[model samples]
Target: MEISSGVAAPETRKCPECGSAVPVDERYADWCSACDWNVDPGAADPEPGRIAAARRRLAQEYGDQLAAEMERAADGGGPPARDTATVLASGISLLVHGMTALLVVTGVLLVVLGWETGVQPVIGVLLLGTASVLRPRPVRLPKDAPVLYRADAPRLFELIDEVGAAIGTTGVDAVVVAPDANAAVTGYGLRGRRMLLLGLGLWEILPPQQRVALLGHELGHFAHGDIRRARLTHGALHSLSVWLHVLAPMPAVRLLDRFVNAATFVPRWAVYGLLLLLDRLTLRASQRAEYLADASAARAGSTEAAVGLMDRLLILGSVEAELRRESVAAQMLGGRGGREARDRAEEGLWERLALHAGAVPEHEYERLRRVAARRGHSVDSTHPPTHLRRRVAASGGSHPAQVVYEGPRAAAIAAELAPARTSLARRVIRDLAG
Candidate 1:
C-alpha cells in the first residue's frame, strides 16, 4: 500500500477487488489476503469495465443478503436475530462502562490513601473532578427553530398519528420545522424523548404515499429502538473524548499529565481502536436498520411508492448540491436583505427541482448509478449506497400503492405546517445573510 505522506497504513484494510473483509496481519500492507489484490503504486489504471464489474459484484452481494433476510422475515421468522456486529457493539459498550467504574473506584481509593499518608487530598480530588467533567450533555436540536406541539398543531398531529399507525408506532413527542432538503428523527434529554425535524423542502414535494414512506422511515427508527442503542454507544465513545479534551487544558501539570497519559495510553487507545472497529462491524447492522425502515415504508404503502420516494430523494440530492454549490450565491447573495436572499435561494432550489422532476434524463440516473457504485461503502457511511438501496427496493414484487389519506387530509396537514415552515425559511435566510 502507498501510505499517505506523514500517515501510516491503518490496522485494517479492505480488499479492493471484492470489498470483502480483509483479515488484518503484519502482511496486510503487501496484499489483500482474501483476494490477493496488491497495491502497486506504479501500476497503470485498469480498464473502466473491470472496475465497474467489481463494484457491481460488491453491490450484488449486499443486495442478495438483504433479499434473503427479507424472504426469511416474510416466512414468519421473528425479527432477524442480532448478528456479530450488534453483539460486539454491546460488548464494547459494556467494556467502556466497566472501565469508567474502575476509574471511579481508583479515584476513591487514592483519596483515602492520600488522607492516611498525610499527603494533600487535592490530587485525588482533582482526579475525581475530572471524572465529574465526563458527564455528557444530551444532544439537543437548534433552539432558534420553530417547534410544534400536538396541542398547537392538532391537524399536523393527526397526520403524524396517522403515519405512526401505518408504521405500527406512536407519534413523536415534538416536531420542529427547518429549512433544508431532508428530515430526521432524533432525541434529547435523559429520557431521550423523540423529536422529529421536518424539512419544508421535503414536505413541499412529496406525494401523499411518498410522504407516508418518508414518515414511516423516520418513525421506524424509534419503533425499532435504534435510538436508545445508538445513544448508549455514543455515550461510551463521547465520555472518552470529553476526558481527552479535559486533559488538553492542563499545561501547568504537563509532566503529571504526560505520566498519566503514558500509563493509560495503550489501554485508552485500545478502547478507542476497539470503538472504531465496533463502528465498522456495526455499520452493516445500521444499514440493515435502514433497509428495515425502508421495508416499513414499503409495508405501509406500496413497493413502488417506496421506490418513488427513494428516486425523488436521489434527484433532490443532486439538485440541492447544484444549487448550494453553483447557483445559490448568484441568485440569492446580492439581495437587498435576508428575506429577499432567502426567497431567492428557495426559488432557485424549487426551480431546479421543477426542472428535474419527471424530467431528469436516463443519462442522469445512469450517471448517479455509476457514481454510487464507484463510491461503494466508506468507513464513515452510516447507510448503504443509494444504488444498492434502489436495487433492494426493486427486488420486492410490486403492489398497489396504499392511500392512507385523501387530498383534503393531506392539505390539512400541509396547511397546519405552513407557518412553521415559513418561520424556518426566514431564520435560515437571516443566518445565511449574517
Candidate 2:
C-alpha cells in the first residue's frame, strides 16, 4: 500500500493518550500530532551515565541561548559579538605552547651540560627523546591513501572553489575519498594546506544543491575561525593528550615500580587537570563555530538546500544501517568469500543506497525532527543539537543559491569521482564482510 511517491498510504487511528484522530502509516510510527503523545519513545531510557546527561543538558541550554543571539544579530544586520570563552581558550593554548617550548629548551640544555660537564649522557638522551616525541608535529596524510588532485577532479575542485568563494575561503588543495558516513575538511603539513575528505556513503545520497551546502559547511570551518581547528590550539591539545598518556601510571607488582608510579602521580594529575580546563574553555567556542558554519552553508547553497543537508544528517543512522544490511545480503548471496563477495557488495551499491534514501517517508522525517527536539540530539557532542541548528538556519529568511551544480557540470564531477568511488566502496564492503 504505497503511493506513487513511494510513501506508504496513511490510515486513520485513535491516539491512546489524547483520543485524537491520527494519520497512521504502516511504514512509520503513529503519533498524535495534536497532543504530541509518543513523539519520542526512546526518551524513557536513561542517558548512558551522569556525565553524558549533564553534557546534553548543557548543550541544550547553550544551543537555545546561541540560537536566540544569532537571530537577534541577523535582525540587527551585525555580526554576533565575540564571547570571552574564545579569548580565554586562545590564552590557554598559547600557555600550553609556551610550556612545550620550555621543555624543548630544557632538553637541549640537559644534553649540552651532560656532554660538556661530564654528567650522565643516558639521562640527557632520554630527556631529549621525550621532548622530541612531545614536540608539535604537522598533520600528514596516511600512506597510499586514495587522493584526487586538481588535475584529476577539475570540475569538482571548481565547484568547491565556488562554494568557498561564496563563503570567503580559498578552496582546498586536494580531495580524499573514503568509506565513512561523514565528510570533513582538515589541514595537512607544516604550511597547513587544506584538504577535503569526501565520504561516498554521505556524498552519494546528497542532492546536487545539498552537496554544495556540504562543501560550504566544511570549508566554513576555516572562514569562521574555529579555534579547535587552528594549528596552535590543535597541536597544543595533541601534545597535552600525548603527555597525559606517557605520564599515566602502570600496573606494577614490584616495589620499585610501585614507587615509580607513585612518584609520577602528581604530574599526571596536573596534566589531566590542565587538559580538562583547556577542553572546557574551548567547548563553547567550538560549538559556536559549527553554528556559524551552518550559516555559511545557507549563504552558499540557499536556505532550502542547507536545511535539506541537515535533514540528511538526521537520517544518517538509517543510512548506515542500510549499508550494513546490504553488506550482509551481498555476502550471503555470493556464498563464496573473497573477491566474489567483494564484487557483489560493491556492485550497484550507490544506486541501492539512493533508492533507500528516497523511500524514507515524510512522516518519518517529522518523527525524527520531533525526536531531535525532545532528546536534544546532535551530530556529536561538540555540535549543538540538530533541532537548534535547523532553527538557526531557518531563522534567517530564504537565500538564493550562490553556487549552482547541475546539468553537465554535475555529471562531469561524478565522472571524475568514479575511480575513487569504486576503490572506497570496495574497501568499505570488504571491511564490512569481515
Candidate 3:
C-alpha cells in the first residue's frame, strides 16, 4: 500500500476533532470530535497508536448515538400534529368547502345573472386564461446546471446497498446530488418507486458520521413512507387550493385588505380575523410536517449526531447575511437565501428545527443580496433561512448545543463551512414550518 505523505497525507497523526488526515505540523496536538479533546502540538507523532485509540474512543461514542436512533426508528411514531398534516388537512377541507360553495354560486349566476347562456362566465374565465398564457412572461433558466456535480455517483449507489443491508431497507430508487445547496427526497408511493436528493454542498463538507446520519434520516423517511404520504397529502391540498384560488372571488387576498385600508372598520375586522385563523391553521400544518420529518430523521440515526449536523447551516446563514450587508441595495432588496429549503419537492425537517430554535444570525435581514448576487441560491435564493438550520443541526429542537459543527479552518478561514453543512437541514425545516 502507498504510504501516507504530504500535509494531507495520513501521518502517524490525525486531528482529534475530525479523522481527516493531518501532517507533522501538529504532530502531537490534534483536534478530536468525540470528546472535544485536543492534543499537544509539541508532542511526537504517535500515528501508530494514537490514531487507533482515538478511533476506538470516538467510535464508541458515535455508536451509542447511532444505536439510540435505531431504536427510535423502530418504535417512534413518525410525526404527530407537529407534523402539520392535521392543519393542512383542515385547510384543504375548509378551502374545498368554500370552493364548492363558490362553484355552485358561480354556476347558478351563469344560469341567472351572467349572460343568459349557461356557460358564459366559465367560458369567460377560460378565455382569460388563454389570454394570460399567450402573454406569459418569458422564461429564463440558467444555462448552466444548478450545481457542480461532485461525489462518485457509483459510490453512492454502493453505499445505498450497504445501508439497506445494515437496516433492512429495500433501498432507495435514485440518489441525486443537487447542484444547488438544498436537498430532498421525492417519489410517488406505489409498488416500486423512491428517490433521494442531496445537495452538492453537503458532499463537499460533511463528516462521515454526520453524512450517515443524514442518510439515515432520509432512509427513515423512506421506511416510514413519509415522503409518499407527505407528497400525496400535500399534492391533494395544493391541487384543491389552486382550484379554490381560481374559483374564489378573492382566495389569495385577505378580505380586509381589499378595502379595509381604504376605510370602513367592522367588515374589515371580521375578514382579518377569518384570514388570521386560516393563516394560523395553514402554518400549523406546515409546522407538523416539519416536526415529523425531524422525528423521522432522529429515528434513523443518533439524535446527537443529527444535532451535530446543524453547525454548517448556521454558518451558511451568517455567510449570506454577511454577503447581504456588503451592499446597500442588497439591504434594501433582500432577494437572496440567507438559507432554508428541505426539498425541491417539500419542506425538510432540518430547517424547521432550526427556526424553532431561532438559529439565524441577527443581520441575516434585508441586506442579504450583496452575497446573493454571486452565491445567491448557493445560500440565499432558496426557500428557508440558513442560520436557523445551523442552530437546529447543532442543537436539538429549540434547545442549543454546548458545542457545534465547525470546519478544519473554522477559526482561520471563517468564510469556509466545510465542517457544519450537515446541520443546515433541520434548522431550515423548523424555520419554514414556523
On lDDT, the candidate that comes out on top is: 2
Write the residue-wise lDDT of candidate 2 on 348-423 in tens digits. 7887888888788776788888888887878866678999889888887898899999999999999998888787
Error of 1 at 245 (Å): 6.4
State which candidate, 2 or 3, has the greater lDDT.
Answer: 2
Model 3, CA-based lDDT:
0.40
RMSD of each: 13.4, 3.5, 17.9
Q: What tens-digit string does per-residue lDDT give for candidate 1 at 1-434?
A: 88559976545556678886654444113344345454322232342553234433444456557656755665566666666666777777777667776666777878887786755466667667766666456767678788888888887778777667877788888888876777888787788888988876675566678877788778877766562248767676677556444443334467877787677666666655564555555555666777777777776667877887776776665545543543345335645555565566654444354454556544344444544455452212355666656666666567555437557887787678767755654454345433
Greater lDDT among 1 and 3 belongs to: 1
Which of the predicted structures, 2 or 3, would earn the higher TM-score when compared with the native? 2
Instruction: Give the local distance difference test score of model 1.
Output: 0.63
> For model 2, what is the C-alpha lDDT against the true structure?
0.82
Query: What does candidate 3's lDDT look like per residue over 1-434, in tens digits?
Result: 88656566344456556665434333123333333334222232233442233332333333333333333433553323234545555665456445445555555555456676647877656544533432212222223222112232434554555544444464566554332344565553344356666664443344554555566555654554442135434443343434433433443377665554445345445444443343334433332233334433443445555654544443454333322222333223233433222232123222332343234323232123222222211222111222333223333433222222244422332222222233343233223223
| Per-model tally of clashing residue pairs | 0, 0, 54
Instruction: Give me the runs in candidate 1 sitting further than 4 Å from their true place.
Output: 1-68, 71-81, 105-120, 227-230, 240-265, 316-319, 322-359, 377-380, 402-406
Model 3, stretches more than 4 Å misplaced? 1-91, 94-154, 161-170, 188-193, 224-233, 236-304, 318-434
Candidate 1 global TM-score:
0.70
